[model samples]
Target: MRKRDLEIIKHLEMFRVMSRDDIVDLHFKHLKNPIGNANTVLKRLVRDGQIEVSTMHSPYLYFPVGNHIKKNSTKIPHYLKLVQVYKDLCEIEPPTEFIIEPQYKKGLAEPDIYCVFKGTPLFIEVQNSIYSSKQMEDKIKRYELLKQSELVKPFPTIIMITNTRYAIESDQIKVIQTPSIAHLIHKANEDSNTPPPPQPIKTNGNITFKL
Candidate 1:
């Protein structure tokens, strides 16, 4: 198999679910006809039993072959949102490392994404639904426990992506609440008096902001 094909499969396995357009943007955008090329390649993969496709959704969602996740799993949307966040960060500066739904020892914090971007370690919590005050507090407490564990040297900052703003304060670790990663990055550049990065190369299937 080709290297790109393997990479695509690995991504599907790692991310749990990805849309057709997500695959195209990440791997085929450099080509002359990205979507066309993606469709052709994806069809072959599906035929070869390398990946599974769900036609229920427009543009279709792809999963690793033999994946346990149900085609109609409710977590599919959440995973897709996480993928978009990763893509946005890649447009600015590709993260050195990005892990989806990284797990920790029992009682430790579980973040939707754990990535190293521009030399900073970050733990991202993507809140699709409004979390109760108690739930939020418990999450913060778990993070606090994680910090105390010192499992990760030079603990990472926690970023909460949600529509509703919550007053999150902690002395152990920095917690940032933002509607989206783009807004957070833009604000960071402004604070440091640095110009925002150039516009993303692929605008389709992505949420674009002026930054």
Candidate 2:
């Protein structure tokens, strides 16, 4: 930074923001002999190319010539935190190129982690909501589509993982369903009288029916 540029920054850092009037008034308070105006200092900085006058975010704020705050909070961004939790629990590492908002024709589906497991691609959606029928239907429909070849193969195993802020376990975790698709379909349709004929339920000879 130029000698004067550094001095200006030290002044700006004193608060979240500063206006020309504030700086001019501060000048009078500091030097006791005011330049009597802020334009002089601003124009000087502008001429030296130490700062640029920006009018985008706020009305006329001065910014460094070409610097930006790239890095942010270490705690995950709010939108990704829940998704990250799913990845952590599932022990599934998401691909770097995976789309956070993967495009699906039916709706705006935001899978927490669109990654592959055991060479099979999967779509994991997380719900931090109190379970509802509509939410349940939406979650299962994706699976039904996958089952009927209505969707694509290596068909994304829809993982609907839920969280109960409290430890008392209930029917929250839909992501970890039984190994068999038939059983999963059965449980999914258990609430309704007629679901449909069970299709093929491929398994690796072992399944978890705990739910």
lDDT per residue for candidate 2 within 82-137, as digits (tens), equals 33433343333334433343555564344555666446566765554566666666
Per lDDT, the best of the predicted structures is: 1
lDDT of 1 by residue, 21-115 (tens): 99999999999999999999999999999999999998999999989899999999999999989988998999999998888889989999999
Off by over 4 Å in 2: 1-78, 82-97, 107-110, 146-151, 164-211
By summed lDDT, the worst window of 10 consecutive residues in model 2 runs over 69-78
- Report the CA-based lDDT of candidate 1 relative to the real structure: 0.91
lDDT of 2 at 201: 50
RMSD over all Cα atoms, model 2: 18.6
> Candidates' TM-scores?
0.88, 0.35
User: Candidate 1 — which residues are off by over 4 angstroms?
Assistant: 194-211
Candidate 1 similarity to native, TM-score: 0.88
